[model samples]
Target: MTELPGTYESYWMETGTGPAYPALEGETEVDVAVVGAGVAGICAAWELARAGRRVALVEADRVAAGVTGYTTAKLSAQHGPLYAKLRGSLGAEGARRYARSQQEAVDHVGRVAAELGIDCELERVPAHVYAESADAVDRLREEAEAAREAGLAASFVRETGLPFPVAGAVRVEDQAQFHPRKYLLGLVADLVARGGAVYERTRIVSLHEGEPCRLTAEDGAVVVARDVVVATHYPVFDRALLFSRLEPHRELVVAAVLPAARDPRGMYLTPERNTRSVRTAPYGGDERLLVVTGEKFRPGEGGPGGVGERYERLAAWTLEHFPDARITHRWAAQDNASTDGVPFVGRFHPGSRHVYVATGFGGWGMSNGVMAGRLLGDLITGGESPWASLYDPRRLHAHEVPSLLKAQGAVLKHFAGDRLRPSHADDVAEIAPGTGALVRVGGRRCAVYRDEDGGTHAVSARCTHLGCLVRFNDAERAWECPCHGSRFAVDGSVLQGPAVHPLEPRTLPDEGPSGKEGSV
Candidate 1:
């Protein structure tokens, strides 16, 4: 096995410990309840509180500690090769709305950071989507034109700050990047100061939508509000059948330290090599942190060596491109892609009156998340937003049918086909230490992980969100459901959701020579 560099953690998370809020202790009432304290939830809560609405922000974990913490933090509207595709699917006006919303999101982040005096390392930089092959240059040019038509200052150029040459690129100015955690934590502090409530480690188990929506926490605490925003990344409460419309993808991020002189000076992305995105952040006095992200795949779909191989590939690519880089931090981030090109950012379902959701940001959540905050706030406050119709969760275009069908097809295969597939190990003895595998114990399927200390933990193989079997992700050391992107720790605790419940605990038939008996 090839050794990969960097500590297995997010660079953002390692930097500082943001302020922590207490979990929901007992029942509470507010005007609105915002679930999941990522960028979307925090921004929404702050927006509502600033508008004199009583709001409560509830998070399953810490604020900005989920996908937001793991992101590359590029607050750019230059989503790779998207304007042209949007023009085709949504026509000219709809594409303009998207561009306008995204650009506003970029400016909103910088404006908020400055207004509130939040030192989040916000830096104004140009963003680029470059094409390496001649065949893709025309598409890049088309995207540049489409973006310009959509009211952006976009231009096609043959030059970039990248070390390697590119055939052509679509460059957009005045975009920015910042430390997501720092920015979010600042908003959270302001939200709290404004008399809005913030709760951490408060997992909402169920939501009862009504005259006053009631959200029940795992510990029996409740939050009553007139409106609810399900921003739990993948929407834990899937009353709208959003799982069918959203496809989950996981991407690997590798960061390394390089001399400040070697910084790329801007964010760059390419569609080639699965997908390559590059940006830099201030590290120390004379060094910058180069963050590279790529290798997008379904949650549990990495072939051969599994996610470990994916990380290796990204690391190798990084080293090849920047020889002076010294690996420092490595992690992964997951996002949901909507069937339609646009995100679903409005009502949770057609029947629900007060229940709303913000999800399916694809990989551009930094900007889309802020966009969701502003839009969701407008909807709850009964104010009109120009981009509301474009992001409506209930809107379904005819062009989305094919993508929806394909996404659902993959889910169906994993739900049924994985059941018939063979387990990773026939018996506990065959499993290795510090690894997990599916094993048949007493004729029942089980997810078993053997700790490095030679103790084994066992849980049912079935995912709580759906009946699909869970597969071990060796690289991340978790059980991931390929169907809907639910992740669980070795002890069966729900790590990422759509699944509010933990995996069912199971008992192993017997202990193997190298493993001691343990229970989840």
Candidate 2:
């Protein structure tokens, strides 16, 4: 398998590595304290600082080291398969509002990049969402119409620069793309220059809320602020039922050295369920990197081999299609998928107006992240933001029930099946070679696999997240959580999250020190 692209080498090397920003040292007061120093937090700090508001941004790790560092970084108003879904779920008015909000975000990014003179390779290019199957054409038409109604410059295209057979595609013109890390760093530098402080290595343990919100950091430092923005991908409040409202999906990405003949100009995406997207980044003069992403699945469930298979699949797909391209980088990023298929970007909980949260960006984090920051900044500064109502977190739309029920049903099936299934190891002698089976081990269920060469491996069937029983998803070849969509490899490695840690490898009686059990 190819080396994953998400490691420090693949990310920090491309963009110059950043130092760990200092943690919150002691009690400090600020106009706004932003949690999670990702694009959202950094952007929020930048906007707040520009407005002459004192801001403090805190990150558990280094800035942009979380999902933001792993993002594919496409800045486009054209979200995949979203317009039609939004129309159905949010109605015509809601759908239009959603589109407008996204467009406003794109424009905001452009304006910021221009004003800051940030050399993040900001370019206005069209984005295409193509349909792989013939049936998807109908959906594309519906999406194009919805986007137009939503006051977007969208149209349908029959042919694209992509080297695949597409039924039809929706194109959102003048959407933008950039180096997310560069853009973020530039904004962060500006914010710091303006007296806005960014504290890294500061893990927020808990939030003390009331008239004023105080965030207690792991180092025992407390931050007193008038308002707080929880942009930690998933809010850390009350273990967040918001996580249940949205499933976590893991997606693979391949950043390949582009061939001389191919210059990927516009952003491209497939409308298929687990489809791929292609875009290009100009490394320098006469040098470019092509990024391909897709192979999405819920965490801990894509079969026996964790996320390693996705890299292999993407490598093969890239080589077969773009043979001249050299596969230099590969990685995976986890995204929060909302049950209603829309992001929640507003006040946290009902009346907790002082605390705001931005979760469930789906796969469009680039656009939505910036949007959330601007919207939240406006909320804090008492400025008028047109996009606020569409992304309201408190509203519960009725249309999301069907999709939510489908995911919940899968979770229920896994929970039920895990209880009834027998361990595959107990009847190992009768099992066929080159296959895996569910088995009982010490009264608990486990996954036991026999290799083609007759080697055996065993792992626990319980998912790391919430302890929901995992089921083998044959299509993806991983153990999938029917509950929140965590996937693990047959060897018990993580394929996705909200399971941040990988599965614990089982110890074998015959193994030595190297073969001992392993955990996160």
Candidate 3:
């Protein structure tokens, strides 16, 4: 096995730990209830609180410690060559709305950070989408023009700050990058100081929409609010069939320490090689943490060597680009992509009056998350937002049908096909130490992992979300549902979700000579 560098963690998570909040114990009432304490949730709660609305920000875990904690933390409006594609799919005006919304989000982060005196290391830098091949240069030029037309300070440039030469690039000026947790924690504090409530370790299991929305947490505590915002990375409550329209993707990130002089000094992205995103953050004097992200794949599909190979590829790419980089941290991030490129940020469903949802950021969550906060606040406060029409969940374009079908087709493949496939091991003894596999115990399929001590732990193979068989991700050491991106630990605890319930535990039969004695 090839040795991979860096500790298996996120750089942002290691540097900052946000404040802890008490879980909801009994019935509580608020004007608004925001689910999930990620960037979108915190920002939404902050927005409502600032508007003088009594708000409760509830989270299953620590604030900003889920997808937000694992992000690359690039606060930029220049989302690759998105403008050009939007121009074609949506008209010129539609593209302009997206550009304006994202740019406003970018500015909003900086403004909020400065106003709150949060030392999030926020700094202005130009964002670039560069192309290394001649064929992609023309596309970059087109993108540059479309971006400028859509109201961004964009230009096509041949020279970039990268170590390698690029054929051409679309450069957008005045974008920024910062530490997400620091900024969000600052917002969390302000939300509390402003008479808003935040509850950590409060998992909302059910939502009842009415004149006043009722949310029930895992502990049976209830939160009654006039409005509810579902900001969980994947909508835990999929009333509008969002699971069919949203496709889940997971990406690997590798960060390394490099001399400040070697820092790129700007955020960069490229469409080549699956997808590559590059940014840097202040580590200490004369050194910067270079974070590189790429290798996108579905949750349960690990391609050849599982997620470990994806991490290896990302690390190799980082070393190839920045030889002086000494890898320090590595982790993975997940996001949902809508059938249409635009995110669904307005009403949760057509019938929903007070319930709103924000999902399908499509890997550009920082700006989109902030945009969701502002948009959701405006919708709840009855303030007019011009971009609301573009992100409305009910609006469906004819162009989205093909993509939607393709996404659902893949889901169907995973939902039914995985169960028919051969099990990983015929007997528990065939499983190697420190590895997991699907085995049949008492004529029932079970996901069993063998510890180095020869003890066996088993859970049902069926995913709680949609009956999809869970696959073991060797690199992350977790079982992942491919259909909708739910994750579980070896102990059958929910890690990430559209699935609120943990996998069902199963007991193994008595072991023979080949099987182990101890079982869980």
RMSD to the true structure for each prediction, in A, is 1.0, 5.0, 1.1
lDDT of 1 by residue, 1-520 (tens): 3566889999999884687789998899999999999988888889889989999999999899999999989998888899999999999998999999999999999889989999999999999999889999889999999999988889999999999999999999989988998899889889988999989999999999899899999999999999999999999987899999999999999999999999989999998989999999999899999999999999888778889988999999999999999999999999999998689999999998998899999899999999999999999998999989999998988999999999999999989898888998988888888789999888889999989888889999999997799999988899999999999999999999999999999977557565677787
lDDT measured at residue 70 in model 3 versus the true structure, 0 to 100: 98
In candidate 3, the residue pairs with backbone N, CA or C atoms under 3 Å apart (3 or more residues apart, or in different chains) clash, namely: none
Task: Locate the minimum summed-lDDT window of 10 residues in model 3.
Answer: 511-520
lDDT tens digits, residues 181-265, model 2? 8888888888988999999877786888777889997668999998998888866564445765777777878887875458757
Winner on TM-score between 2 and 3 is 3
Global lDDT of each model? 0.92, 0.75, 0.92
Candidate 3 residue lDDT tens string, 259-319: 9999888999998998899999998999999999999999989886888888898999999
Q: Which pairs clash in the backbone of model 1? A: none
Arranged by TM-score, best first: 1, 3, 2
Cα error, candidate 1, residue 239 (Å) = 1.0
